[model samples]
Target: MKTWKVLWRVMMVLCVCVFTVNIVSYPQPEVTEVLSKYGSRSEEVRQIQTKLKQWGYYFGSVDGIYGTQTQDAVIKFQKKNGLRVDGIAGPETLAAIGISSSSGSSGSTGASTSDVNLLARTISAEARGEPYSGQVAVGAVILNRVEHPSFPDTIAGVIYQPGAFSCLNDGQFDQPVAESAYRAARDALNGVDPSGGAIYYYNPVTATNEWIRSRPIINTIGQHVFCM
Candidate 1:
């Protein structure tokens, strides 16, 4: 009887050890990092809404609230871009939308990183096939419009102004941005007026507006004629 008891105690100890080992070796579930999702409200959410609205993805107001509407919009954007359709604005989604997760303030030009990204996207959309100098010139024309009294004073305002850019309506603005366009945007913001101080530019071969053609020509770069 004493031997049996001792053997039983030993078996219990062995069972306990096996259980502890299993507990220690078991795989843990991955912890996902969520940047924005439903019930989240912040400046980042507002920026996301603004960008989606600009791209014609979200029709709701930019109230900074990540509700069902916001989630639906994010899902749509993800679907269009071939991203994971989780309806959560994770790092990848934020980066794809041209927004930085960092809270860094605007640059010396009083333009935030998003502004540079928007300008770069515009240059990419409008002058993707143009020469490097022409790309910079396109960015310069947009910046000039921002400074001109007749146009909006803000970059977003000027870019989104009704009928300002044809690319915005022709679906070209939604395409991927070119790498050169980023450099052109930065140069244009730095006051590199490759368009020769001209506030307007258009491709003569494709330009349909007689008024734009009638504008006094200032410089010619690549296929675009810069005008005032």
Candidate 2:
């Protein structure tokens, strides 16, 4: 009886050791970072909606609710910005939209450094020989297209839209950007509308497209004509 009791106690101890080992070796589930996904309701969502609306990505009412409309807008923004099209406002997406995820507030309303550079490059390519205001007018037309319902809702989108800009195909876009183009881009981003809210512009002397020539002219800057 004594031996049996001792053996039973030893087995119990071994069983307890095995159980502890199992507990220690078992894989824990990965902790997923919480993100503003569909159905989430908060001020962050409202900010996201506001930014999207301002950038012409979202058309829904800013009600702070993450519904289908918000998700679809997020997807559209993501696709336009070359982000993962998950439709969830994750940290990356929030940062891309110029919003702080931790504070739930917006960052600077100005264009990012990359945006400025792109706009400058485009201005340099399209209007390097024109006056300073003319270069800014070109940038303004690009920004106007971003806000227009008929064009893509982002600068890069509008600039790179197939057959949108002739410079993209004529090798001028790849040339060194002019120094004044940078200032012009910044001025245009800062709400300077030398284009007079025009969504289109072209050099009448070089433009051969009849469709573009038919656009109602808004203003003339240097060699280019700004149009609606």
lDDT of 2 by residue, 1-228 (tens): 999999999999999999999999999999888788899999999989988887677899999999999999999978755568999998667756755545332225445555677788889999989999999999999999989999877776687676888887788987888999998988898889988999999888988999999999999999999999
The segments of candidate 2 whose C-alpha lies over 4 angstroms from its true place after superposition are 1-108
Candidate 1 RMSD to the correct structure:
7.5
- Candidate 2 has its poorest 10 consecutive residues by lDDT at 101-110
Deviation in Å, model 1, residue 29 alpha carbon: 31
Global lDDT scores for all candidate models: 0.84, 0.84
lDDT of 1 by residue, 1-228 (tens): 999999999999999999999999999998866578999999999999998887777899999999998999999978755468999988656755756655333567656666787789899999989999999999999999878999867676677666888997798888999999999999899889888989889899999999999999999988899999
For model 2 the local lDDT of residue 171 reads: 83
Runs off by more than 4 Å, candidate 1: 1-103
